[model samples]
Target: MTEKSMLVVSAHSADFVWRAGGAIALHKKNGYRVKVVCLSFGERGESAKLWRKGPDMTIEKVKAARREEALAAAENLGAECEFFDLGDYPLRVSDEALLRLVDVYRDVQPAFVLSHSQKDPYNFDHPLAMHVAQEARIIAQAEGHNPGQKIVGAPPVYAFEPHQTEQCEWIPNTFLDITEVWDVKRRAIECMAGQEHLWEYYTRVAQQRGVQAKRNIGITVKRDIQYAEGYMRLTPAVVGDLS
Candidate 1:
């Protein structure tokens, strides 16, 4: 319900959809822009879903389809998307990679930066993304550290919940209300025909979180609400009570 650009970095292309699409859509509808940076196209990460399409699809073709699906999904959510094309599975964040990512942080300088939680179920890009983003936070703030970095003044940064709750350490202090934009979120997710199965998969996750939020606040967050996204402010975001 606020107006400010947000940058989301994910370990894979479809991640922004399954985990954070609702928030992305809500952000855009509220006059907040968004940019998603995927560390990989998920080439080696997992392709059984994509391969189920047919036996003839090549690796390149699957990757291309994923990018197409992601771009379409992002647009539907009112956000733009980009992929670093880093090989998935065993993504390594080189010192140079850290510098490069910081470059993007500098260029976008989004009011809020989002990325994977440091904890994840798998042993791959999720942790790499978390580490890279964490380093970027510091590198972006490091004066004269890399004059070549493309972003601008540092913005508020946040960490998002991962796909597997138990695998990653996700300590979310902020729960965004996507009830108003839930439909738009659903529509955006549908764009990922490649991940239709995930719809049913994540719906439950959303419901669980919604119930948790309501219990914590002692208010019922309607059942029509099927999805939500969570985050923890890396920097304090104080409204009215600036004390």
Candidate 2:
């Protein structure tokens, strides 16, 4: 039997760590192969703390630091990470880069794809990443893209939680109970020292989502959910039964 895998397309190095760390860790524990593709190191935009370290902080240095942090985080979550180093703060994806992502789609043939919300007013890069991820998946499904290559199936695409869901118009229709893997996710979050300010914020987000998840399931379920990650599934799920 082929190994099941999941893909995560991140706008920046720390995006997957912050938004989908719990999902990654939980899936990894469940024996799924996790692959993370970071479009950029977020050196210019997301690495503000590094940039504030005087004039000695160069772009190369910042990129290296971000890459190291992302690597550590991925390791903690048992994921394999690939960096595009495409640059950020106005991330531009060339046709070549898009095709490269399509190759990943074909190779991994992920069971599901995780990315940013379709609309994020605060950060244009976030939405663009999701756009690219969806586009690549479509291309990978087209047999003409690469004649003999195996075509990927229609894997469900999910938008992980955004920083500000209200402004982004992102609603969580799926909640993953990540209580068992929360510790692994927390360790991964700590690996992102460059964005220390958001550590506690995401923790609270998990806690809030956990409460919401518990409420949604009603009182009949005996499972106690203490930590959760929310996702907005962008694709249709075929089911045999509604309940």
Candidate 3:
């Protein structure tokens, strides 16, 4: 049997750590090699904490700090991290960048993919990342898209929960009970020193999702879930048996 792999595409360096660290850690524990692609370092817009350190912070400085944080976070989750370094603030995904993502899709040949929500009013970059991820997935599956490169298999794509779920129109259709890996996720969350305010917020989100997961299906399984992550599957799942 072939080895299973998972891929996650994020708009910013810290986005994956905040949204999908639990899922990444859980899958890695289950013998899947996970890869993360960060479109940008979010240096300009998302580095408020670093920026507040007086006027000495340069773009390079911010990028370096965010990259370090992201690397630490990915390491905590047992995943490999790649950075595109595309500038943010008004995060734009160029055609070249999209092609790079296509290359990643072909290279990883991920069994499943995770990305941002399709719509996010608070951060347009989040939705843009989703668009690029979707397009890259489609292109990667087509043999003719790149003449010399081998096409990749179709993988189910799941969008992780956004910060403001209601505003983003993100509904959680899948809940992963990550109770056992919550500590790992917490450690990953702490790696983002530039975004200290979000640590507790995401932790609370996990707990709330865990409560919802418990009410929804935990009772049936007779399991107690203290932490969970929610996702919206964007692709059809094929299985030998529905159960």
Top candidate, metric TM-score: 2
RMSD of 3: 1.2
Alpha-carbon lDDT of model 3: 0.93
Find the candidate with the highest lDDT and give its number: 2
Write model 2 residue lDDT over 1-243, tens digit each, in one string.
Answer: 889999999999999998999999999998899999999999999999999999999999999999999999999999999999899989999999999999999999999999999999889999999999999999999989889999999999999999999999999999999999999999999999999999999999999999999999999999899999999999999999999
**Model 1 reaches what TM-score against the true structure?**
0.85
RMSD per candidate (Å) reads: 3.4, 0.6, 1.2
TM-score of each: 0.85, 0.99, 0.96
* Candidate 1 per-residue lDDT over residues 132-157, each given as its tens digit: 87778777877787565454555766
Q: Model 1 Cα displacement at 97 (Å)?
A: 3.8
Better of 2 and 3 by TM-score: 2
Q: Which regions in candidate 1 have their CA more than 4 angstroms from the true location?
A: 1-3, 53-55, 146-154, 220-226, 234-243
N/CA/C clash count, model 1: 8
Q: How far out, in Å, is residue 119 in model 3? A: 0.6
Kindly list the per-residue Cα lDDT of model 3 for residues 1-243, writing each as its tens digit. 777899999999999998999999999999998999999999999999999998888999999999999999999999999999988878998899999999999888898899999999889999999999999999998878978887888899999999888999999999999999999999999999999999999999999999999998845588889999999998888899997
